[model samples]
Target: MSGENETVTYRVEDHVAVITLNRPEQRNALNFDAYDRLERAFRQAVRDPDARCVIVTGADPAFCSGDDVREIMAGPKPAIPPPPTVRHAPTPAAMAALECDKPVIAAVNGAAVGWGMELALYADIRIASEKAKFAELFIKRGLTCDVGGFYRLPAIVGPAKAAELLFTGDVIDADEALRIGLVREVAPHAELMDRARALAARIACNPPLALRYMKEGLRRAAYGDPRELGGWAIETIRTLMKTEDHREGVASFLEKRAPVFTGR
Candidate 1:
């Protein structure tokens, strides 16, 4: 099932819905259209009776580099102001992968930065290539973490490590990610997808109903109540979006220079 846009592609093989991020030229950095398409693809996979598991990967050389800086910052500003409802409600795309009842496995082939790393965190299991790199780069954009990163990262890698990553926005190699339990296994670049599919197939073999129930149970155990934290995160992100530091961050990024944050 291909997406409305070619930016994302979804196909089923051996009961696994393999969703590929297709924009390798931008390192699969998602623009608004790609984000919407990705969310739809995940929702489709969840609803597809034939797909018992879902595997997300990118077209070689990169998994996802997070948002397209140019698209977000360099694009022309809107002439009309956004309505109040738009400002208050967070986008559902950020949590679409997590909302899926079937298991999600991220095959991190290469760089997974910012929301890219956050996307992997949403997965029930993650498998990375030896060449894979991960980062929580929201700070670099003068933005707070979105896409459920604030809620999921701490649980997967522990609070201290998660804080360090989020605060510094440092990139970590696959070995470091594996050591910290961010990924279950790391394979050679060529075998990354193969390993992911093997695991997906194993899970797909299980009874679909049982898998769904197990996923729900685990979700409840890990996240007792997501509402309060999720609300705070969305509001904080909205506040940060209007800051001068964020504009500077985006400008510096496009100009290939360092950002001078004023803490505004």
Candidate 2:
């Protein structure tokens, strides 16, 4: 899928699919072309059976600089704004990773600002390098967080922390990211990709069906009232009880052996 999409390069390694943002010359900015191309790349991952998870990161010093401002301002600003919503969705390619039953992890290799941060937000998990820096950046530019950042950040870091970040548009490092629960872990700059792949591999080894339900359960909990979450949790557990992996897991515990799961 490398040459198939000009703005994004899709690759699979050990069942961990990755969509690398490749426009370093432009700081991997979310140009319209990038958006359109990424939509395709993500859908490709959705159709890949061998892939149970994915990682998205940039090729160089910046994960993304957000939408290409030069491109957007290249034309007149729309008299009417898009309103408060996820800017990159409705395109199946961009929404694919978010809606995918499989997990998606973001490896924030470097600076992530503006919509770039939102791209990471859409992932199920986040891992970043110490060198990684993040900021909402919308307010700084006389705009609001029109992308998914406003919605996703609070869910990851809680409402207060998310408000602080958005209100100040302050840049934060990896340590702060970990403190706020925005990222699962942080690694040295040189080890960022290795760590991200390792985490993805771990999630990939879990039973795919159970993992899918687990992800759904979490998303459901995040988006709704407590009663809905209670019902979903019960149903998910019931479904998992019927899987071969669950039987193996219990037996392995009883037999004092490591469970060998084939994502059944």
Candidate 3:
């Protein structure tokens, strides 16, 4: 099975669903519509009985560069007090991947920064290309990270290392990531997808029900409730979005200048 939308492409091969972020021109940075499409793609994979495992990757030259800052940050902002809502969750795409029953592998072919790193964190396993790079850049943007950064990073690479990455917003290469135990394997750039597919095939051969239960069991036993964490992250981000420092962060990036934060 194969299908595609404007920003994402979906296909299933040998009981493994492959979802690729297709906005390579923007380094697959997601805008609002892209986020919606990505969420739907994950849900589609979940509903497809043929899909026993899922691989999430991005177009060549980059994995995901995080949010489309120009569209998301430079555009006219929404009111600070958003309209009342019944529920709070991470971005739809992040939440969908977090809840996906099938095992997910992130094949990081290039840069995965900011929300892109969060996307990688949502995966059960990660395989990186030699060209891959990662960073938790929310601090540089004067905002807190999403649920993945807060919930999964520490668990994957220990609390102290997680704090170092998050606080500094430093970009780390594939070798460093592997050394920190952030990725299971690093393949040659040209062989990244093939390596990821091979791993997916191994996982897909397992009993689907058992796989699902094992994933759920792992989450329950290891990570605490994502809902509670998500609520805190979202609320904190909302507040930060309204801060002068965040405005400056976006402006400085756009202007290619160092930000002058007032600690406002």
Candidate 4:
């Protein structure tokens, strides 16, 4: 970690990896450094065998404030993105986390806007604090949200609601987040992380391979045509059935005792 050490930090406990956005003073606003750190951290988490699940949250009050406009203005600003023929589109870190074998839970502690809200949308589950506020505020800034926001939101909340949120850029609090099916639960600010951690721990206690299969199965099923995707799913299910964890899961169910999976 360089001077960007304050950008993002990764920590692991009880088989749960937590990635925290650390620039609370800036409302954890992201720039190049934060994006780079996030991409790197997600890649590392994907490869870490010790990680059974992940929880993403902020280090301080706000979960994130989206992009840092001041930094963008000071830097070389492209008036508008040039033709797609020239540059490749950037990949979102949240997508990387979502596609990983381990499940992710987002602990939304405070304000989550634009890219920040997109990041939370990537998680398998979201738990927001009572003070948490969410908005897809790209319209307010005269920008458009990236892939995670555009694709995941509609899928999560259906077309009409997603359109309402994105098109208007209205701020929504935790209760609305739950009503719209955006958050799993809303807790007091102090208990948000603990609730997230407890959920992660429960998921971690399960057979890791089963969890992986479950996650992968659902992901592929989303927007996947059964005609073509069914083949891959068949192979995937066949492979999962042969794993030691699969056998352990069956035996554990019969024995009425928890399974001790070794991630095999």
Q: Candidate 4: deviation at residue 65, Å?
A: 0.7
- Worst ten-residue run, lDDT, model 2? 74-83
Instruction: Return the top candidate by lDDT.
Output: 3
C-alpha RMSD for every candidate: 2.5, 18.1, 1.9, 17.8
Worst 10 residues of 1 by lDDT: 78-87
lDDT of 3 by residue, 1-264 (tens): 244447888889899999999888999998877787888999999999999999999988889999899988777755123325524666667778999999999999999999999999999999999999999999988999989999999999999999999999999999999999999999999999999999999999999999999999999988867987887788898899989999999999999999999999
The reply for model 4, stretches above 4 Å from the true place, is 1-4, 77-94, 223-264
Writing each residue's lDDT as its tens digit, candidate 1 over 148-213 gives: 677788999999999999999999999999999999998999999889999999999999999999
lDDT, residue 185, candidate 4 = 92
Worst 10 residues of 3 by lDDT: 78-87
Q: What is candidate 2's lDDT per residue for 43-78, written digit by digit as tens?
A: 888788888888999988889877776564233542
Per-candidate Cα lDDT values, in order, are 0.85, 0.73, 0.90, 0.75
Q: For each candidate, give its TM-score against the true structure.
A: 0.93, 0.76, 0.96, 0.78
- Ten residues in sequence with the least summed lDDT for candidate 4: 224-233
- lDDT score for residue 92 of model 3: 64
| Higher-scoring candidate on TM-score, 2 or 3 | 3
